[model samples]
Target: MLLTAIAPMTAEAAGEPFDDEAFLFEPKWDGGRLLLHKQGERCEIYTRSGRIVTEKLPELREALADLPVRSVLLDGEGIVLRGGRPVFDDWAYRLRISQAAKIRTARQTHPVVFAAFDVLCTDRPHLEEPLTQRKARLGELLQRGGGILTPTVSVEAQGRRLYELTAAQELEGIVAKRKTSLYIPGRRSSDWIKIKHPRLIDTVILGCRSEPFELVVGLQFRTVKNKPVGRVSKGLTVEDRDRFLQAARELRVRQEGGVQWIEPRLCCRISYRDRSEMHQLEDTEFLAFLWDKQPEECVWPYT
Candidate 1:
């Protein structure tokens, strides 16, 4: 199946802009991107890459076990509450379980809830419709629903104001989507625009690698001598991981099934919070390097 034929917009790409009067702005949640398809008792949960992750979110599976609709597709984020707020870390804990025991532990330690935003299909297919209509239908479906729906403001000025408010609240950021745009399967048109939290960091892509399981990007910081140091692997979008793998394959540089080497490009931005003393490395005596950035870039907007 063609990638574009399935879903149009991703976190990295924003769609086109609509008329000022017809756009809707929504708060971007600081959680894992998610898509849920349900057919009565059975459910299929997908990541942005179309990877099935239903087993990881058993709590959500149980929550939607007996929905009225026989089949439905919805897009949103899976959020886990932390300190009266929904933090991305909580969601990450729920999504990255590898061991059976770890899965059970995650369930008990950090229960999660699905914060649905868009309904792709409902009895009748609705993805191709304008976002305005889809949102209306979604509102009806969630009239008294338990999950949190992303709050939206149709006015651009109000959208910006809300963005500031959310930012002050320490939330991630806001997504401004054109309300009148059709849901094009895979195009990253200008209809959907994402105004991120301004949490930008420059890092170097010192090296690339293919993990034993998931494809990952390896990165490190540039040392004083201008050499890459502190190599760390993992943490990347499936799209990015796949591209990294493809590049490695073309280079034909697989060493005992480890990561491929890539010269630091000094490109890429990341969002991160300062690590606390509890997270400080034991090898370092002082809590050095308040910010962690890949050697490629050294801009830390979130700090």
Candidate 2:
């Protein structure tokens, strides 16, 4: 069976980090989630969504192919590091390149490191094995640091401390996994929890774009002025898109330059990294529609 057919286990989001002896904490790498399957001398990489990306990352293929094992299935994150921190934008750009010439150039300029965290198979399947056992096997199979393939470092029970360190390092966040949990394919289990450091803001819907579908959001300033912050589309579900569009049609005020202007009555909370000089939200993702929030309540500075 193709490894891509096996969906990687996902983590539930946690609001805050806590000290837990039952859980092992590791850095939540800020890049694409990938699964590598190596059989004999052939290796393939797949995205979380199961798209085969082996061709896009030839260097990773070569590295995995060189592994001493006969066959292994590994779950990891593909990241491009700069100044000791993962640079997601560079990794994202690397995923988009298709031309052979450009890909060769990118391999030299922005090489990606695969941070293996979980082992699904090594000579045989290990899905029923506990996470600790799987990790132990993984460590024995692979080298620890400074390589194209590296192990994801984890602390036994210092979830809070790891979270703090990641925040200080400007890293993505931390993941806490139950030490005895078994890998369940395609499931979002509570055994693993992800704690991210993202600032949340509630913004009123100002307008929307049809093609590809993005929400133009803003904040109310001085009780009357509307300040456009940014456009968001990521994390919107099919239901969310349908519901928002249905409500938007009723609130349609005007259309300008392909944007469907709507009355700023609907509000939603979004997670963002920071704001630009123009005050536009950066790295913004839609969280949820705020049915209880009023447009006036989403004021500037987002207090």
Candidate 3:
């Protein structure tokens, strides 16, 4: 079915996933978020950005076509597994494969699977229905041992354990949803909270300090007022450390306390704890230099 407007609902980040009887928790799959729609032998796929990608992943469309429902809209994540863990790096290749022959070859090498999370529109419209009810309907619609798409396995009142397990398994994290929450399309509501493991963030490099033995780098988020929100001095491979030092030197703007303040031109991705009231990212550890993310995109929550 051709949907003129089927914008998927968005989730807001939470400080951490909490265990509550009023919520259901599921592992937040790390990959592209795709909305699958099937109508009377017709199946189509859409990215969260509203791009129509039906022909991109033929396996996904074929899998959805096998469903028994006449009309259904399923929200899911398209993940490619590597060593039993979802990896977005491989998913990038899947998304970039455009040629029909190349797509088939890529699918074989790195197959993508769907983990359905919600049922937006089924036999009847269910968007207005509370998430608790929608989840029940979703389970009924896609039972276990189904095709390529499987409903997201969720836990009730066990968020703390779930988050720990997800982290230990080197997975992304868990998404906690209020049982009574409705699926409000295109809305980033607090009712559905995203509690990612290893809280990864993209920040702009503001400066660096030469500590007694190591180099401590300062990073910030917002560009309007570039205030250092965190410090990262360790957790880098030898190659990364060299690359960082070279970038800092080239982008140097000033010097203070043996610290070379650099222009906010380079961006880096890192894992950090929640920001303190004083606006500092505590326990910040470097993950990788993010050349893909522009410095202008580094906007912290201003919390």
lDDT of 2 by residue, 100-151 (tens): 9999999988899999999998778899999999999988888633388898
Candidate 3, number of clashes: 0
What candidate 3 gets wrong by more than 4 Å, as runs, is 199-303
User: What tens digits encode model 3's per-residue C-alpha lDDT throughout 1-303?
Assistant: 245447778788876668899999999886888998888877889888888888889889888888777788888899988888887667766887789998988778888899988888877888789888888888887774255788889999899999999999877788988898888888989888888766677788777765532334344433445666777865766787678787677777788877677777788877774444345676668887887777767776321
The TM-scores of all predictions, comma-separated, are 0.61, 0.72, 0.70
Candidate whose lDDT is highest: 2
Q: What is the lDDT of residue 116 in candidate 3?
A: 88
- lDDT scores in order: 0.56, 0.86, 0.77
> Which segments of candidate 1 are over 4 A away from where they belong?
1-5, 11-19, 148-157, 200-303
Ranking by TM-score: 2, 3, 1
The clash tally of candidate 2 reads: 0
lDDT tens digits, residue span 1-303, model 1: 211114536533332222355567777766776777777567777877677788888777766554566777777777777765667656765777767788888887787777776777877778688887888887777654555433232454356676777778777666777777776555677777766554323344445444433322223322232233223333455665565545445444344436455544334444432222122111111111212444434422221
Residue 135's lDDT within candidate 2 is 96
Candidates 1 and 3: which is better by TM-score?
A: 3
List residue ranges in candidate 2 displaced over 4 A.
Answer: 1-4, 144-146, 199-205, 208-215, 218-303
lDDT of 2 at 299: 75
How many clashing residue pairs appear in each of the predictions shown? 19, 0, 0
